[model samples]
Target: MTVHPSVTDLMRRAEDAELARRAHHDALTGLPTRLLLTQTLERVLARRVTHAPIALLLIDLDNFKQVNEFLGHDTGDAVLLQAAQRLVAATRAQDTVARLGGDEFLVLCENTNAAGAGMVAERILHALQHPADGHGAEARVTGSIGIATAAQHHGPTDLLREASAAMRLSKSRGGNQTTLFDLRLGGEAGRLLDIETALREGLERDELVLHYQPIHTLADGSLKGVEALVRWNRPEHGLVPPDDFIPIAEDTGLIVPLGEWVLNEALRQLSTWKRAGVVPANFTISVNLSPVQLLQAGLVDLIDGTIAEHGLTHEDLVLEMTETALILDRSTMMDTVSALAETGASLAIDDFGTGYSSLSYLRYLPAKQLKVDRSFVAGLTTDPRDAALVAAVVRLAHEFGMTCVAEGVETPEQLEHLRLLGCDLAQGYFLGRPATAEVLTRSWAPAGVN
Candidate 1:
């Protein structure tokens, strides 16, 4: 007779088997856990007798925070699950897919070369660009992919580092694309890493500051509002411009916190002016929104909360977003822009008519103001094409019940051109250089407003 197991023993063994499976799988997406992926990488590394190189592909959802923050976390979870399925569908059957935590996935291809890796990454990017659910409006997120192929002298840690660096490069370039890791990226990545660390410390030390640029009534040069611009005051580097450091912040995910601080501080300054009666009730302060910040979490609440906390109304704030960025994920962005508009705050499309103009969005965008790009204004008096475009923009904005503001007005002629074109507001060096709050309020703000 054969030895037979009891019912109790059978149940216990099945339970243990399930627990082991769970340990190696992600609870949410059912993809391989990072632990399992590592073990798979190691096994492939050690057993490799062939000359074919293995490739590691990292997938990170760009602006995923928008889903979690604007839409509910439940929606974000469903989107992640959808994303995991898409990753699996896009890869080879033999490839191992893993969830490296929160909107980031990794694939290990045992026998794939760099070219094959590129193909797979392209497919993955395409798959992720679709809506998560059947509803075209939901799950509107895209992937930023990074590829790293095994070389003659590399280990598991090196592979991870290269893949991560490539992903950072993709994100720094505004995401929704793929980047391959190479020797050139190594130094730039290292330098950016240093800046990222220093910037984090700088935030803690409160080294970032805001300067206000006056928005003027083009006809009379009277102040209407001020736009807040961020600047870094590094200890050793003197003053660092945003162009030099913002990409690092975007790549490292520091823009969210940095943006939050700017919102709060700008509102606080406006509140101070309000209390002193130096500002009219209609006076407003505009804050620039980063593309990353636009898609990050709690943007609406953060704006609404900060405004209320600072004893200001929604009408006192003017939020500006780049026209190009606004149209990136049209459906998702339109939703966020709608929610923000619902809060009664004014919205302006910044840098309007920059090459990425999407005419379709203008009709649907809830924004009531458009800032004519300085590029056109720079050529206003000289180029008839530029003059005609500015004139048409002003007329178009008025037709839609919107205000048209012209930026980068440097000369009296430009100001006169804007005034003649019926441009509502103007900002630039000639209008007023960006100045400290104390200086702007004391110097530009009228002693009294009727």
Candidate 2:
């Protein structure tokens, strides 16, 4: 049957419109191309002779590469399409969304100030966290967003760069969030840069040191162990906390070397403490392990060699690792833990219950202790749910035959509560703040012994 002339004309017009639309949009998601977004922004900026405020947003999907690597590129493409759809839904019609490249998108919010841009960024983050349709499979995508406003000094490219920098800042602070570029942080940023430079030279300059935080047994309130916490004694920056510089180290691929330094320093210190009679020879010396360090080749050999050099038993050492890291690199983590345990060293899951890892992973890990995350313990004084959760974790740890240590025990009430819950150990400012190795040795040394 022949179609009516009017219907054929209308159909032809719709086909032409679809072709034009496809010409300027991403084939998979139908989002505008970067060229289209840039052209649109140029038109908007061109009209602003008197200078209207505008913001640029850089959106990055965290660990998208890993998803693609493990789940295949088809899955990755689907995730990107879902992300594009959510972004389009969250954004205003006036706002432009563009697929800049793989796993990165750009949003140009016209006639909007920095605060307005930030609100849009938050909306994008929320959208990403929303469940996505995975064609018979369920999954969630979380992302990080960075915002920067156009300044007199910034061209379109500079605005893009600033937004990228802001995104990097969000990733450095631990991903799945948003950050806005602030001129007020110029000084702080410079200082952080300087610290990063100094940290690079820290090992060679012999400026990094280890401080000891005492871990006490809850039953007798006696010191059973001390965790070796690394500190950077920058000649110019004074003392730099781990929270301030550790992320930088991890980002810059410095954690592998820095972690090695921590291990050597802690082991030497443990030897000294034994020689000085500051603690029992067989007492455990716990040291924090970064994921990078665990994944490093020859980690087993490194730890074994160190233990052999110090003539210390494996039982005399404990390695603390966060559950987040464990989840990120499980196979390597399990291998490293097994190797450490083979050398008689024990492993402890630090900051437990803070991330999404299931408790079933506990069976495969060589951990002897599980330290409850501080955030949970902090609310134990008032929140019954928090109290019950903490108690349940402790019970789980006990059932697994793993000792439970409640961290952030900063109050008598917290301590008394933990004692009632039968927590195996407690560590925080309340028990005794972290101290310099010398001070720690002196404080815990038996009278007239050293």
Candidate 3:
């Protein structure tokens, strides 16, 4: 204690301290690391026995990887920094902002409950809605927040787990949202993690399958074609609904491979039906094209090769493009649609009146059919405005000499209304939910109806 410290020793000590600090904090945002988060959570839980309430807000940036891939890592880093600043600004001085690694940020709010946590989440979302600085471009960011409140009776890990689960529900509902924990659903977030793992291995294990729903002519009730829908027959998860996994696939960019698998499998099934003479030679099998699939570089070529591999004519296969996807990039999307048409495959705009159903985009796309959305069909009988909308859609399709397909005809009244409006085709739960190829082969015998 009496001796003076050496300069070299002081420098070495300073370097070691800096390294330790870096280990406990995020490099880019200088926020607390996951290690720090855990320690804070433990301390807060210990204090919950005496002090007021506390909550954790788990935030995940939606589609941040897409930004990283499309832009560069540098731009992505800039976005993360901006997000960190906003998070700090949104929370009070007492709260802690931590980076739990890539695109995941957390806030530990002391003296807060579920209601208080919800208010904080709203503020954070509103703040993130502002533009983020990244080089010269403005990066638009959105977050999904999951709130976990600390109670005297709750375990620290359990509270964090529930909050993470709620975050997943928010992301599932589409990002840029928030959700609170519920006892029911038994931690869907945990279930989703398991499902994602299974989905990755599903293809190699052949757990994924396709089911087809028939589309019939409203006037004559003759089978026109079938729309191929994908299903996951998991070993333990039983039957996972498309609504559950499809959004996950899209967000995770697994839709590319899943889409390809669906196309190949659907085509293979169609081929078998043809060989067995169960389906008519002129019948078509419609496949929904995901936006990511459409954006792929070799989409047209891949489709052409699949058709060639299946030994199927282009007319025997139809591609159903969602109107929302068509509105994304007009010129390039139109070009791809035109290229598909060149291969002799027909195109139908699914959910035609929904989304941003731009007529200008329609004029450019080489679509031969328009599938009216279910919402317009739901009240077509009782609602005159709905009937008029359907009538106008039919007339518009007719003007272009394209067929009009009315979806969601549950009641006889709805079917009759569609027929009166001169709709060409009808498909809905009333017709049938999607069925396995074997079931369709045995049950759907297209006899003398045509």
Per-residue CA lDDT of model 3 for 341-448, tens digit only, reads 888889999987764334655666788888899999998988999989999999999998899998888888888888888899998888777899878877856542
Q: Point to the candidate with the largest TM-score.
A: 1
lDDT of 1 by residue, 311-399 (tens): 99999999999865564334445667898999898999888876334365577788889999999999999999999989988998898
The TM-score measured for candidate 1 stands at 0.68
In the range 1-450, model 2's lDDT, one tens digit per residue, is 996679889999999897566446756666775557767777777777556889988898887655554444455567888898888888999898987545668899988998899889889998898766666455566887888888665666556656765777777787889988775666544454555567777878898888888888899887888888888897766888899888667643567789888888888888887777778655678998886676565788898888779877678888888865655434445666787787767889998876544465677777899999999999999899899989999999998999999888899999999999999999999988988887876666676221
Candidate 3 wrongly placed segments (more than 4 Å): 1-189, 444-449
Give all candidate RMSDs, comma-separated: 11.2, 15.0, 13.7
RMSD of 3: 13.7
Alpha-carbon TM-score of each model against the true structure: 0.68, 0.63, 0.62
Worst 10 residues of 3 by lDDT: 324-333
Which candidate number would show the highest lDDT if scored against the true structure? 1
